[model samples]
Target: MGKHALLSASASKRWLSCPPSARLEEQFRDEAGGSPYAEEGTAAHALAEHKLKKALKRRSKRPVSDYHCDEMEECTDGYVAFAMEQVELAKQECKDPVVLIEQRLDYSAYVPEGFGTGDLLIVADHVLTVIDLKYGKGVAVDAERNPQMMLYGLGALELFDALYDIDIVRMAIYQPRLESVSTWEITVPELMEWVEMELKPKAVLAIKGEGEFHSGDWCRFCKAKNTCRARAEEYLKLAQMEFKAPPLLSDEEIVEVLKVADELAKWSADVYAYAQDEAVTKGKKWAGFKLVEGRSNRKYTDEEEVAQAAQKAGYTDIYKKTLIGITEMERLLGKKKFAEILGKLVYKPQGKVTLVPESDKRQEIAASTAEADFKEE
Candidate 1:
């Protein structure tokens, strides 16, 4: 597969929701190299693919030495185990179940120049399952009504529907770092219905560059988010709101403002960072802002020499020792081995209460329960 498809399944959530974004993003050139986070994620995926393929006795000719790391090994091992569990479950239901690793899926029928690689695909009697490995911990991806996974399902259906008597499609997102394994199921007919109705129209508009720009949470990952006129207008509406003497706002108004504030803050920060980079690195200047050296602390030219001089001066107090962090210890010993050895020594305390939006997935604590717990303490 090509490095990037114009309407790539990964960005389906953004472009499908805001069809005009596909064309708008094409106007700007992407940064030359991937971000550190993207590179880490890519390495993790390579390791996961290697592990899975090795387990299946389908190892690639390419060496996995460059991608091998302790953390990557652990994360990929978990992903492989989870995927194998799903395959085993499928095996129980079908006479011959097949698992495909890093399978290239084509969704061009529903999206122009769209395709994505499924980390794992399992096909069994009247059922197809698509598993995706997400190494990033920035956001928890849900499988429910996920357009990306749905498009993958469509691609898998195009490839295997004729071969297998598939009726149900299962989409799973495995984020091992977050300990999240979310799965959602839909009938083949329902998926096809969505493709025929919602997907095809949007895909056509996106490909033709003939749709209106609408901003929401979907703009979070859009390349043009920082400078998008629609987003600016949306946030500007909130900024232009009438300011009372005490800045009193109705509950409904507060809710509306809160919804836009998060995205607005992120956009503002992104714009600032982009402008700073342009000014300092590319010799481009903004009208009001000038680049300057950020605050930093002085450091010794040679730490070893400084340490020797300090010790020779009878500075014994400079030295200290401490136990390794729990996370580092667990990493060194391996999670299971560490838990087996020191399970009883570890204790988890109740986390402090914090305010969050109602949409947060965490269960809310009752006031009575909090009072009762405090009394017991």
Candidate 2:
């Protein structure tokens, strides 16, 4: 853990997974420009905070909807709506609503050691609530024992301790994508214990950057993917696999064969680029072995004319009704059904996109569209 440790939700996960890499990244985060997605998330959170404070000031609970709020389009809208409703309900139903605050600030331990930013912290007469809005639909957040929320709760209690007689501090993870809210009622001692025992130690280790690479699906999105030694070795070994068709080559021969294949692949790419450039500069059209000067793209024009001629011959749709590529397949099968077939009908471990049986897919289309291949006359 360094002085510039990121005390955010994502930081914890990264620190635990790859401490060295996380430390390297975090230490140089300023040099690494902020991600667009992060900027969007921050913008959405700001909007939500503003709306909540506005609702509190007016003593009215009005729903805040963001039509073009891209950062929060996924979960912010729904979570913000639910939280506003809860605040309004608290005012209307509860005995006395104390304070509805936007960005009620708090910190863990001390500034250099532990620090956190809360999305929203509300303090009532008898209860304290901290709400975190998560926009991602991929992972559902649970508030119970959530370190991020726990840290937020700790900060809130510390800040508002002297101001109000806070009895119970409740934390909530409001996920709009799931249309769900999970709450955790924690005592002051329990929260303190969690922070000191679990969060602080973890935070220390994270700051120090002492973790191992625990491989998982999320590795696909990790920045260290290309440079990771473990991944590179595994991929190299996998690539070296033989066809097993014949045992014609010895160990040395096999190595040589692979080297030749690798070299050929690189050479082929370079040659292709050179040939394409020369053909263009020399004013010669090249397709396969055929070459012509001052003329290019003959095939597409010729094909169009042939298609028109075929139409004249009373053969319509003559662009060759070849097996539609995957893109066209997706267009033909709308998003929902295509997803169903892709996930449910397809096999696992190898989550490959697969087409369902013709009859089944057609039946799905018929049911949804209320017609079977309804081509206009």
Candidate 3:
């Protein structure tokens, strides 16, 4: 909890969804060394900050990091270019538009000690914009009504709302790895309306650690997700659906089941992982479970030695080569170079049909698309 508030903006999605989870999360300690993904993101942010500051003719030193690579280099360059465009636009509104990089913003008026560092904050008379850089590719982050970005908006407004005659607040997320750039804009009055009604109430409940626990997609990153009773009951309710129905689940029941199918599998895996960790590390054995060796395959301790031994034994046809994965290739060549070299040669096949909730951003494939596939098969 070094810099993490009990109701931090980053975990607002989880805490707001299940307010009591803020207190529940306090029971679990942070992972000792943090995760590689988070560290990589930090490195990328540091580099991006240096690049943006330099672009603005500010004094800053370029930082060296192990995570520096062609992909990061190109992405940060793109982010700096985007920041420069915003700066140019701000200059149209005022002669001296202030640009702040890696600034701490406070929103304690709404959230208790609710503050988060914004990646970039640009100020002008007409508009105030806060931009964030997302370095991960696992999931696309949209700024539309995003709790993290909105909180940052509140924080930024708190800093300069009176100083600047700002009518609109713009929050943008730049996720280059996913080829996503999202911006959500709201008038000051409209933003305050949401703050007074929704965000404030949620923040109050979260700070008090008082509210009914509701489990949903928000539980994905909750610290207590593995053992939370509310989550267990949510998934268990789906199992109970089998007996509650007559002989088969009706259409509505089936639809409800489909909604939580992915979450159900995830919950099971989380429980299994927790149980294994407890048994192995804490020696807390389950009633009917015991630790045992898992399946393994033999591997060469040193691949070079293995290759030499194989060649010495007259094994000439030992290796097979395949084209590198698209992501790795892109990183190797940089985005611009990759496009110039192999853009036309690349093609994407239709993905296998899968069911998802209506809220998913992907457009629904035409019924004829699946029907045509069936006919071909």
Candidate 4:
């Protein structure tokens, strides 16, 4: 697998769950550097590294990026502050705490050529902590039983287990955008037990592409998600499953539908987008679907000219003015200044309740009154 490992630590979730997907995804190589979101995440990581290095008293130059903004600055500052806190905690037990920023960790001992770059690694006292920064806010990341963090912990152990006699492994995910700061601690023996019993076997199957294809939440980041047959089958099954019940659905049936509703909608949208692109770009057509001119709203060729003409014609009411949104206002003023100036003026109303699966980590709302309380000013 050239420079990229077949069982890369970042993609471990997909491979470990559905080992065959590792090779299946090899056929669909994404475009260079992936999507705009990926590029933004890369920049965030670079900025984080610069900030953390400087915080640790190491010489480093500040990074320049289009993504550099108040939000990125605030997030990176939070990350550095967290790392410094860990360092101080480490100092309580050990004379010298080793902190590595943007550390290249190799866990090839457990998996074939398995290596990943961790955002931060702190080796102090008997704790080996691996902290990672996730810049995206689309999905919240959890540190509990996360393969990526576990793998990073293993790589850190390989480097300092003997030197520090590390007994405990701690992994944290610092996702500032989601306001997520999750940390999970495990004993060295417990981590190794998981490696030997679960990870090693999964790695072996993933390298050979010998295991069955299983689909779940892990399919989100898979490269072949849009085109994979297994995913299509899964979503199709979910969609068809919805309508097969009786006219008046039972409580159990309603619960079952809720499990797959969100996933089904996402899959349908992805398939439609891919199909539309293929029909337009490659002249690929499906028998049932046909190309047609999509609906569009009218627009002026030159807005300034149109405005001038309208004013000259005694029609000066073309403008519609409104106050900027809360987000825009916050962006206009920096987060701190915004809070200081308008904190009392702003109030978050109660959110309307929605039915989500039990596994959702969000606290259950008081549905009895939540919907009644939702209102617009």
User: What TM-score would you give candidate 4 relative to the actual structure?
Assistant: 0.94
lDDT of each: 0.85, 0.58, 0.89, 0.86
Q: Candidate 2 lDDT (Cα, whole model)? A: 0.58
Judged by TM-score relative to the true structure, which candidate is superior, 2 or 3?
A: 3
Clashes of each: 0, 2, 0, 0
Give me the candidate number with maximum lDDT. 3
Estimate TM-scores for all models.
Answer: 0.92, 0.52, 0.94, 0.94
Model 2 regions more than 4 Å off: 1-5, 16-22, 27-36, 57-77, 88-104, 108-113, 210-377
- Model 1 agreement with the true structure over 1-377: per-residue lDDT tens digits: 24888898899988888898998889988777868778788888877887788777785653355645666678889998998899889989897798888899998877887899898899998999999999999889999989989989999998999998999999999998898999999999999899888899999999887788898888878889778898888788986877554368776777777777777888788788778877888999788777777899999999889899999998868767999988888788887888899888988988666556798899999988777777767
Instruction: Write candidate 4's Cα lDDT for 228-292 as tens digits.
Output: 88888876775565465465787787777778878878877877888898899999979998999
Which structure is stronger by lDDT: 2 or 3? 3
- Which ranking of candidates, highest lDDT first? 3, 4, 1, 2
TM-score of decoy 3: 0.94
Error of 4 at 331 (Å): 2.0
Candidate 3 clashing pairs? none
Candidate 2: residue 99 Cα off by (Å): 4.5
**lDDT by residue for model 2 over 155-262, one digit each (tens)?**
787777777777778888876656667888888777777667666665666566665654333344445543456544543553576645448657775665554454
